[model samples]
Target: MVVSLKESDFFSKNRRALAKWISAVEDRLPEGLEFLQRHYHRVGHAFRIGITGPPGGGKSTLINALLRVFRARYPEETIAVVAVDPSSHLSGGALLGDRIRMDAIGLDEGIFMRSMASRGSLGGVSEATADICDLLDIYGFDRIFIETVGIGQLELDIISLAHTNLLVLSPECGDEIQAIKSGIVELVDIFVVNKADRQGAGRMVNDLEYMLGLRVYSGEDWRPAVVSCVATGGSGEGADGVFELVEKVESHRSWLQARGRWGRKNRRNLERKLRQNLFHYLQREFDFLQPLLEQKAEEVEKKRLSFSEALEILLEEFSRQFSSSLKKRKGG
Candidate 1:
């Protein structure tokens, strides 16, 4: 059966429809792109929070705790979580399915949880992550949390999409300090030291404070807060810091709004999304030239053409074909 976007159920707060639309967008279907384009104006209402750090840093646990706190504090608001995990090499599915750790949140009707595979992307996120976030935003979620796969210095893509970014750290990870030194510290809005009950947690907090002190931040700028938490503990005993974390996130949101930076940030995010979509569209348009590209490769392998010569030929042919197609469309 063909599902039409014109159906009121598709645009309503229907979980099945939302899931179907996300899957279509992930697969890069034309109908999916059209649906998003039609509703582009409805985005930018939700507060996006990004959580990232090294593998086994207890990011999922921290999010689980945060979910409990948020649900308790704002029982009426809706929440959505997008957990990105490393992809399985053989099956191309999320390896860990972090949702398993968030089973408690899954039971809440106000909360929506999705697990996405990184698909071997070095940025710790999949290409369709931003699109999925957009869908969630338009679906009227009050808050959206995106947990990235294990990240490194260059995996800062989350900073562009999230209004506030939390860098999760663990006392058990010996490389925590080293990872911070790799430039990840500069990208985060909050530092969360999970597993505070373990040894070295205080030292990690001190190290982060010292690093922050080195940077000459303006007095008017928002200072990142470093909080400690034992996310795995029950009855909120280990999650004492979750409240402070929520407070800091709210403070940052207020700071951005008061300074008139929220609109600017949303515009910047939209620009990035536009650039990404244009690049992908160009790539799809170039698919027709693949056979010719292979032929050029064969010629180069046989020493009939140099690499540069083959590239020039391909570009010239592509330009000619593209121009002809434009003319045909105009005439028809």
Candidate 2:
């Protein structure tokens, strides 16, 4: 029988149990996941907001600021932040900084901070981010904030998982022209100019204005707004909506189809987690794949096999292992 945790159990009496439960949930363990699903109904009422941008865009600082506002405005509300970032190359498999960046709100008893390392999973996201959001939502968090890695084009995946996609940009980001890039412009809901006290803040705002003008002329009804923030100050930073520069979320026909993609998207996301599980079964975490990849490299070096042939073997092994994993799950 499943052990039922009561409210008293959550209040210091069973603190360690709660911690382990949360850890298990973040890791996406199958056994621990059941507790979440069974109790999800208790946690199913929260708004999920997604914040993403390029590296050093001040997303962490901005999120920290947002949490302060939320706490003051809605004093009774509970908030949770899930930071999805790659493992620091030097640190092996841990976030570059979660406690440091989130120092603004981490100490708050009302705010809960959780960092999920990408651990080499690609697509610029944490595999469990959305699921964790859902779990936090059901767990009674009033607001759930998801912070994505700001690297390359892959980070945009946060759009499918969040109700609001706040695309944060640093005032000094490489070039102003990047604002008009099709892929970046389309997915961003709110354009936040973080580190606004910096020199390029005005120029960055002007460049964005020019870009938005071109977009306004288009038949698109949804107009993305640009907001300035000084995230380091922890004031109006990441406060993209503070200056009336907020994207009015209207129900768009196209966007509905776009937003509706979540259902299908979640399915694919679950499949990815499943694949991670299958790989873990085959290799016991990181051992199998890297060694196999290394062997493939050696084979290629000696002309023993082509890269395609090596890839085929890997795929075949994955398929075989995946089928076996499914059977184990069935038997379990």
What's the lDDT for all of these models? 0.82, 0.66
Clashing pairs in 1: none
The true-versus-predicted C-alpha distance at residue 46 of model 2, in Å, is 1.7
- Pairs of residues at least 3 apart in sequence or in different chains that clash in candidate 2: 43-137, 43-138, 43-139, 43-140, 44-138
- Using TM-score, give the best candidate's number: 1
Q: Highest lDDT, which number? A: 1
Cα-based lDDT at residue 148, candidate 1: 92
List TM-score per model, in order: 0.84, 0.69
TM-score of 1: 0.84
Residue 240, candidate 1: C-alpha displacement in angstroms: 2.5
- Tens digits of per-residue lDDT for model 2, 1-332: 35444444444434355555566666667755886667655643565677877777878877777777667666898888888777877754556656575765755778877777776656566656656676666556777888877774426557656655677787667464464476678666677788888888889888887887776434434566678767656344445443332222222223535656435434554565567556545666335467787888899899999989998987877677667767887995
For model 2, the superposed segments whose C-alpha errors exceed 4 Å read 1-18, 40-44, 88-93, 101-103, 152-154, 176-181, 215-221, 232-324
